[model samples]
Target: MKKLISLALALFMVLSMIPASAEAAYTQAPMLDGMDLPPVAERMPVEPMVEDADYLQIGTYGGELRRAADGGNWYNGKPIEEGLFRFTTEGVAEPNVAKDFDVNEDATVYTIYLREGMKWSDGVPFTAEDCVWFYNAVCLNKIDSKGIRNCHKDANGNPAVVEKVDDYTFTVTFGTPKYDFIEALTVDLKWHFAPKHIFEEMVQCIIDGKNDEALALGKAICGMEFADVGALGKETLYYFWNYPGIPTLNPYVLSTEEGKNNVKGQYYEYVRNPYYWKVDKAGQQLPYIDKIVGVTVSNVDQKLMLLLDGTTDFETVGMESIPTILESQTQINIYEWAGADWGATQIHFNLNVEDEHLKELFNNADFRQAMSICVDREELAGLLTDGWLGGGQAAPAPGQLGYSEAWATKWTEYDVAKAKALFEGCGLVMGADGFYDFADGTDLVLNIVSVADSGAADTYKVLEPYYRAAGIKCTFKDSDRSNIDNDLLANAVQVMLAPVTNIGDISIVLKPNSMVPGYATNVAWYGTMDETTATGDLLKLIELKKQLDVTASTEERTAIALQMLKLHEANQWTLAYVEAAPAYHAVNARIQNFLENGVWSDIYRDMGIAHCQCWFIAE
Candidate 1:
């Protein structure tokens, strides 16, 4: 009888080795016939509303706009200096200093005409010369400015050069024809104009007298490398600005007053740019708010609590806090969480590694596909969050550019059996210890790395069990935010949970070449361009992005978008997930026309706290 029992147990184990049938499989639905979604007129434009006389008029007066944020340097927000030309919201570019702009044939050259009479806050006349000089200081000269670089390289892979046409006008020429040149211009933070007078004067001082004072001034303004300003001609300035350019710009002049708090929060207040050129339809001078005060508070919980208490106007919240925030919704109205469909959250597979066993498991397209099937985003969303922060449609989050509900619904579904079948069918047999192993005797284990922050810590804990049940060994590693740079460069991480900038421009997010040096936001899983055999689909997506600038028809753009989506779905660069916590802005209840999106700082101009025109004190 004992022999019979032992034999029965052995038979059961043998049966388990046979692959189980999948409860679900990839279903190829009929290709969607082009159906007209809502007309472009019905959908929201990047800038949805023009000024209206009946627009809520608030008392335009002096008041400080207080905001709380996680740790960031004054250098970080220095891009705001680019004024009129910078991005206020995702995918939308409005004139900052330029009253308006004009583009030429093929959208390669952009002629930007600055609004005359605009001056630096210091009362110096801001001219076309200033614009040209500023461009040169940051881009052409590559001065160590706190701006972002937007222009493409020449055929030989050098920064594109700019030419000044006149005091009010300058033209930007790209190395390659860029359809989204204007979009790129608007989002490039490095395009911020510096006061040429201030910069040139410093350089002249250094050249006239190469003393310690002059050297100190040069270093203060341009860093230690600028000890000899004589060599810093137009060409030299271009490279200098590329790395650690002076964080100088017009929007918010930097104040030297030091703060007693953390260095991150020390001594920076953004005063209104008196030279700010944009005006309301009624001809009122813009930037209605008196001042913008950014306080550095690194703790996320403290930041959220401050928001609840009305000490801070805005705070970044994620999925873990959604339930808590929703449960306390009576405190305030949570504005739209911006990243609903911006991009996807993906489990990236490292295909370039030389390990035979690791490559065989990870590079197996079927294995990856099987892993994707078992991940029920809906269930994860429920377990991870609550309220509006739950499982959402895949692809671009809903309400974002290039989002398709049909595609989202078709791809995102829960089927555990299918995942199991695919796992077993791949010839991974279970061992006596209950862990699955491949034919060559390799066990499946994964190490996930995330920033050592509260949000990430909570998320990793929640996801631990799901991976364990699938016979996969899961390990979590915590990394400091400061070490993120070195970690990514050294390939010291396997999986990283980080927030990507959501500007709504797909080109910036997907292009392999887009991940330039200093632009560490790009997921490094793909490695640099020299390292990988980027598929034809990726190359085609880059080509389509270049076409976005000139393509006149939405249909053409949509077709390109669909192709990109199909590729993304098949390859899984991003794993689409729901926004866990929408951002919450607590106003004085008198503020009106406050446009809130998922992006931070996008609605500053429209806020009653920033632009006072739309605000009124409660009676």
Candidate 2:
């Protein structure tokens, strides 16, 4: 008996010496140590999102990633912003910030379940209230001055109601069936939940009509005063990077104080969020890199040099830079991402032009078809992209969803005789100067406006000779980008040449302005019709848009989108020079885990959907 007791005592002693077995915890970056923050497990949600995709490599944490931001910090914003859901390479909306979600039978209600313990960068718990607050304060109240968007409403035009179910769950109920609402939430960044705790008091002040108090609170948060509460709220909420104190759900938070002032030649830095709520398969907290450093390069030359020298980690380059990248191999690795742009350079003739004759000509299907077939797209493609990209119509590519061969190939054939005949059919008379004149004997001169110093200008230059050969007189009007933008907004642009981007199958559904009309971005048809005049092709498009609004299934939505494109094809509303081209991005070889051939889509959030959290710098 004494020997048995001794044996048990010995076993206890051994177990005690071995130490109590604690729960396995995730390993956070060493930089987070001694920060007086919670443990990795505590900081994470109840069930932290595990990024264990086959392509993901367990990366070591340390070192800073250097990237160029020629435009502004906003260029870097998309990669970091987290919405309720994220777009997949296939343009499907998958779970992201929201752990899971459910839709009712008719799809009028969406119940979103967020991660239970997820916290904002500031360590405040993120809840359904944040989303509800945004709906009530911003959407319902129109604090941003942009009234409730059409998508946010139902068929009856009643605003969607957001109701909080619990701290981590909420439901959005539309007055009518909104089947594509989940995709809508994924595509639109404005719908993402805001940090209500940060903005509550100021919002209350604004709601109470205490303008002075609201301005003071906003000034304290943003470090700048605004002319009004609306401007103040928008800059503070939408442009959160400019005010870093406002918490973020992003992997990294801006560490630089410059904020909005981090302009050309200035540098900006982003530090990894210690409270980031994701982990790799190996149980290491992400993002793998310690920091992201944004450096400004004034020109493409400087950018190219930086890329070759490995001073910058990554930068998107055009096909024109392919030769330079190949010649100077250095430490740069080049790969192509499937481009989403449908029209490399598309022409939009203002259908609402004040000149009656011009408007009639622009609206005439034969006249538009004549202009389209006049330009030799094959030669234009060669001149523009050195034959890298093939000539295509003003429609989605074959590989893209919603692509219709019948629609895409329509009016795309290069036939000068056919074009001239069609022009004559439209009442255009051949004049003494080898140019066509209007039916009323007025000189048929079109102002082909484009943003100055842009690729659109180059396209216009190439198209000028074609237009001249086709007996169409047009003057290239290169205007400032801001001026062109203002004109587009005011529907004052007569004939504009611009890149028609983000026209992917899913993108078109979200931003249908390019084809459906009635939007400032729809320079082709903005102000073209009123309630009385909305008929024929426009009426068909509007009805199709209604179907798209309530379409839940991806297949049905795609079908509806194709129908809309068919209308445009039949009408020849827009003209195209080149089709979608593959996008090339150069990355420093040291940048590990960067997606080599990810889909390059603005709708898919570019690198944001590439799992940037898994990227690391090789030692």
The ten-residue window of minimal lDDT in model 2 covers 14-23
Q: What is the lDDT of residue 309 in candidate 2?
A: 79
lDDT for 253 (candidate 2): 82
- Residue-level error in angstroms, candidate 2, position 530: 7.6
lDDT (Cα atoms) of all candidates against the true structure? 0.47, 0.74
Tens digits of per-residue lDDT for model 1 on 1-619? 0111234334432332212121121111011114333222222112212233233452354555556643443222432434545443333455545645666565556677765444555556666776666565444433442233534442233455567887777877765555555544554443446567757665445445644554565556534444244444321233222212333333344343444222244323555444433333333334455555666665667766766666654444554554566675534445553333333333444443344565456555567656655566666667666434455433555554446666455435566566667778787776667656776777766766666653556666765666556665667777765465456555554555433232223343323222222232343444332213444555555455445434645577667666655665565543444432344544433344455443533322222113332332232
Best model per TM-score: 2
Runs of candidate 2 exceeding 4 Å displacement: 1-24, 204-216, 225-233, 258-265, 353-356, 402-406, 416-420, 428-445, 448-454, 468-486, 500-511, 518-533, 551-559
Give one digit per residue, the lDDT tens place, for model 2 in 1-619.
0111234333422332211122155789988889999877778887676776567788998998888765543467767777877765655566678877778778788888888888999899999999888888876776754446655778666888889999999988898898767666665543467889888899889888999999999878756678888777766776666455668888988774765344333777778888888777677889989888878777657888887778888888888888888888677788888776666677778877777888888888899899989989889989988888777777777766567787677788999999999999999999998999987789999987876646677677788898899999998888765477567666677887873333333367876756676532455444454334566787778778877886767688888887877776678677777877777888888988888778777667777767777899886
- Quote model 2's TM-score: 0.87
Q: What is the TM-score of each candidate against the true structure?
A: 0.69, 0.87
Clashes of 2: 0
